[model samples]
Target: MITISNLKKIYNNVLVVNVPQLEIAKGESVGLVGNNGAGKTTLFRMILDLIRPESGEVISNGEAVAGHENWKNYTASYLDEGFLIDYLTPEEYFYFIGGLHQQTQAHVDDFLSTLTDFFNGEILKKGKYIRDLSKGNQSKVGIASCLLQKPELLMLDEPFANIDPSTQIRLKNMLKSMNKQHGVTTLISSHDLSHITDVCDRILLMEKGRIIKDIATSSSTLAELEDYFAVGQSATLLPQIDEEENH
Candidate 1:
């Protein structure tokens, strides 16, 4: 399980994200939703130990995560293009990441074996640098790298961006299967409410750098989500509608 206590991030002496407490149990699928600059990415980075929070603690599996020495062993994340290796080919990138994570070459081969039928041959045969590959293909490679490690916690930021609709559907199915089959806790951020509503068990709505609303999938819809981001309305409005529907 991952736990956060009084987490806060400050930029130029201004408060950004401040979560007094939050916890994600094992095998849970949670979606982080927000408008631009809502501190979603910053919070995610803190969870990955990529950036230090100004104060408070982020713990994973009973260990402090901010400077945890073994973070790579339990966490896998793909936040942006910065995670990609421009100079390496797709196959080489996989090997590199796997090796850094202490996975044997055979482990890489075994992991890719399952995905062999899923990917077209072109990505495997692309001898050129990963930077030369199309954006969609590159995203496929990045995702494949993260899954190769098979980490306990998977944090993905906008996993569907820049990919084709067909591939997006495929990825969604893959993630859903992973959650069900492996019980891997996943935290994904997306602007598309449909994506969150379709895959996530719970959703956290972030606005102006704070989580203003938290709702389970059984309690919400895409249209309601649209209104949440439209005018920065009060979250109390949601529960009232839910109450009215029950009556």
Candidate 2:
């Protein structure tokens, strides 16, 4: 389980996050949706212990995540290109990450075999360094690498952003299976309300660094979120619909 209490982050006198309390039970899939600067990435960083909060604590599996190393054994995340080793080829990078998780070469190979369809034959043995791959392919590599660890907790920020539609569907299916079969807990932050609603069992809406709405996914969830964004045009909602209509 994940727990946050009195979490707060400040930057140059501006508050980035302020959540009095929150909890995500084991094996739950949660999606975070918000406009830019809504503090989604900052909050993910805090959860990963990549950044320190001004005050509050994050507990993972009964351990304080802020100053603990045990959580690393069961947690995996892919936030952005910054998380990858650009100099290494995809295979090399995967092996390195696998080793870190105590996975052997055979274990890594078995994991990568399952992702061939997701990679679409464009990633493996391409003889291209990670930096040389297109943004979408790079995203595929990063995501696949994260799963190679077989982590109990998986966190991804915008896993659907740059990938093509086919791969997006593949990833969504993969994540769903992981959650249902392996019982992996997942936290995903995305701008696509449709995709998030499709994959997540629960959704969170954030604005101004605060969670304003939390709802379990249902038939009405997507429409409700769309309505919220439509009426909130001036709120800087993502891919904001323009006034011009296509005829």
Top candidate when judged by lDDT against the true structure? 2
TM-scores for candidates 1 onward, in order: 0.90, 0.93
| Steric clashes per prediction | 0, 0
lDDT of 2 by residue, 40-142 (tens): 9999999999999999999999999977999999999999999999999999999999888788989999989988899999998989999999999989988
> Could you give candidate 1's per-residue lDDT for residues 89-163 as a string of tens digits?
888898899888888888888888887645666478757898998877777788888898887889999988888
The best candidate by TM-score is 2
State the displacement of the C-alpha of residue 96, model 2, in Å, after optimal TM-score superposition: 0.5
Tell me the spans in candidate 1 whose CA falls farther than 4 Å from its real position.
116-118, 234-247
Question: What local lDDT score does residue 65 receive in model 1, on the 0 to 100 scale?
Answer: 79
State the displacement of the C-alpha of residue 32, model 1, in Å, after optimal TM-score superposition: 0.3
Task: Write down the TM-score for model 2.
Answer: 0.93
